[model samples]
Target: MATGTGIGTEIQISDSSDEQVILKTKMIKLDTHNWVQWSCQMENYLTARRYDDLFMPPSEETKRSSKFRQKNSSALALLWGCVSSELEGVLLDNKTSFYDTWEVLGNICGKNSIVTICETFYELISLKYKPESSLQAHIHSFQKLCARYNSITSDKVLKATFPPKLLAATFIRSLNGDKELTGLVQTLYDIKPFTPAAVISRVAIEHSRRQPNEQALFAGSSNKSMQKTKWDEQKQRNKGQRSGKKYDKPGPSDKNDSDKRMDNIKKMLEKLQASMKPQSAHLTTESNIKTVVPTLMLS
Candidate 1:
């Protein structure tokens, strides 16, 4: 008897053993084109829970009965939890019994209306490959759409059919938006026995082949980006060192400046020594003349 309050609806019912049976709505949620499978699963599940009686219309006497009302309430809870949000809204708006709600669902999805057929046709033609999902899933979805469209159109006044060639073509067209799968389209068309099965098989093969290549490409690009980032960081560090406030160690520019200063000092020392040599020579000449004059006087 446990239940959830809001959109994440859960209804628990007791089985013969009095164990709680949790309803998983996702497993039986009615999709746009899955009424056949959905109805089957729903019926099977409800039958297991002994609530399949709700599938039939309630008589006037049973409608007023307390036991029938209780069963109907549980059936309604299960039905509401099993349907998608869109269909849940339709059920809510009707505000009817379980049998009436079941009837409404059958009318909308069980029997193919003109509007439903046209919508399915439009969706099949306009479907594109979404990168979020795999190529295989895209192809499978296309196949399902084709099946639904054909099934619905089979009983129409002007019966429509999707041939194998058209299905293959439509699938290929759907894959056009995906860069990786687009290459296989022409190859699929060129192969003999152009059919959906052939195209799907080829696509699956190509997808498996390209998976490793894609991962390798991603790894290579990531490595290159990492290297570039490290290089940039090193460059920035060198720039900061060159412009650092503290000059504790001499850099290339500092070493160059020190060499220039040493060269200038050497040149200045050489010039001073050259000037002192000439003055010494002149003094030595003057002393020799004095000595010569004195020696001549003594003789």
Candidate 2:
């Protein structure tokens, strides 16, 4: 018997004449154990090889494999199903491991996958798992649609993308207080910067001119009430940062208004004294006449 065969992993033969003969066979099956073992096996198979035994830190190669990076909508559908909609506590049951799986999922598919995944997962529960027989006719259709989309494989583009009606329908089905739904919405919001959001920014800016408002959004436009807010916050941070440095003693720029007024008075007095001198008499006379005539003529 082989070393791994003791727990039912391999096959063994009693006598072999050139050709191999199977005396006994062993296989892992769902009948004996629930999905826990199967899920673990699937997860391991996906993440086995890595740079380091302790931790395989992120890098370029790791990112390329993410389902999130590929924009595979199916990944989103499956994620929403398992985690957001809590498809039978499937994701939560092995959360630690699931998180590990999610890291890879996000790296490959792009985070948008989460929203679709959650929506699809909820549909699966409502249509197939829980609906009473009366409204259950579409159950098979639902599963059939989801069969190839469980979690989005990286190497293929088989089943069609869900149409907007179907996609939106699935998401709205379980509007259950699934916290992950918030994350999914956030992902959708972030990925749509190039679409209607661009137009929305222009419209919002026009509205801003008519009303007082604030938010640091609009990428380059003044609509960045949020950016302005952040800039203000950053300015405060910079002030604190400068305060921390061992700066030189305050310079002339730090002088008070009184000091500036005194300096201006001194300059004026010096100018008046210079003008009163013998050499400045002509200039003073001309200046005095120019100053007096304007007031006299106006009066």
Candidate 3:
């Protein structure tokens, strides 16, 4: 089997006999969310089936060959089968040849243009782990962005500018807000050969380890909220009771004190009147004695 396509491009032709690569498992269906994975898987499928040459532009020498036509047809059918129903429109007018369909798919879903590469690079670096979402989901999203960045960048002249180790570091950096996961990932990075798979494995173990603690914290917060509500209700009830009966108004003890003060003033006034009457009676008796003595002497 010719290893090279004689076009300065290196091709890997399988040593296995040219047997029909029957579909053993379902191929990954293409969707907006999974374009990176889909393209990667599709390329693997193409290479394995020895039909990857259909992806390249047909040279003048082989463009008219019947062998190219047969292989191109098979590759085109494979692409059409992999596309999801919603994205079927992308293939409608673009399916002129295998190369055309592949390029169109790359331009649309793969974002093969320079502008899209920049956008994808920015997205990959800025991808952060959301605390509200599951750890596994965040990791999955991180992996997708890394894969997407590589896929888009691979189309450029400077292919795969960022290495896998660099991508792993970027992923670890994305976990800056999470101390435990960051530490765990960093330790794994320092301790062993740091790959994306290793980071994911260690992070997953740490996440599972922390699950019970997270649940306990959530339950504790719920209990605190319930207690606060109960306290607020009790306070409102006490306030309502105090409002119903005015606590500041005079009570029975106050009224009794006022009555006792009035009785003491009345008793003091009676005593003063009795003493003045005695003084007046004594003065009158003294005058009568003087007059009686003078009359007896005259008799």
Off by over 4 Å in 1: 1-5, 15-41, 50-73, 80-101, 108-110, 130-134, 143-161, 177-183, 244-299
- TM-score winner, 2 or 3: 3
TM-score quality measure for candidate 3: 0.46
Best model number under TM-score: 1
lDDT of 3 by residue, 16-108 (tens): 345543443345677665566677777886777777787788897787887777676666655655776777787787665878777777667
lDDT of each: 0.70, 0.40, 0.66
1-299: candidate 2 lDDT, tens digit per residue: 32243333442322223236433334332221123333343345323322122123344564565532332222222233222222324434433333455454333333334444555555564642232222123333554545534443222442334444454345334332434334443444343343333323432343455233223333446645767897796566557545753223333343573366445655664588686868765644545654754343234
Shift in Å, residue 273, candidate 2: 5.6
* CA lDDT for candidate 2: 0.40
lDDT of prediction 3: 0.66
Query: After superposition on all CA atoms, how large is the RMSD of candidate 1?
Result: 15.3
- What TM-score number comes out for model 2? 0.18
Ranking by TM-score: 1, 3, 2
Tell me the spans in candidate 2 whose CA falls farther than 4 Å from its real position. 1-268, 271-299
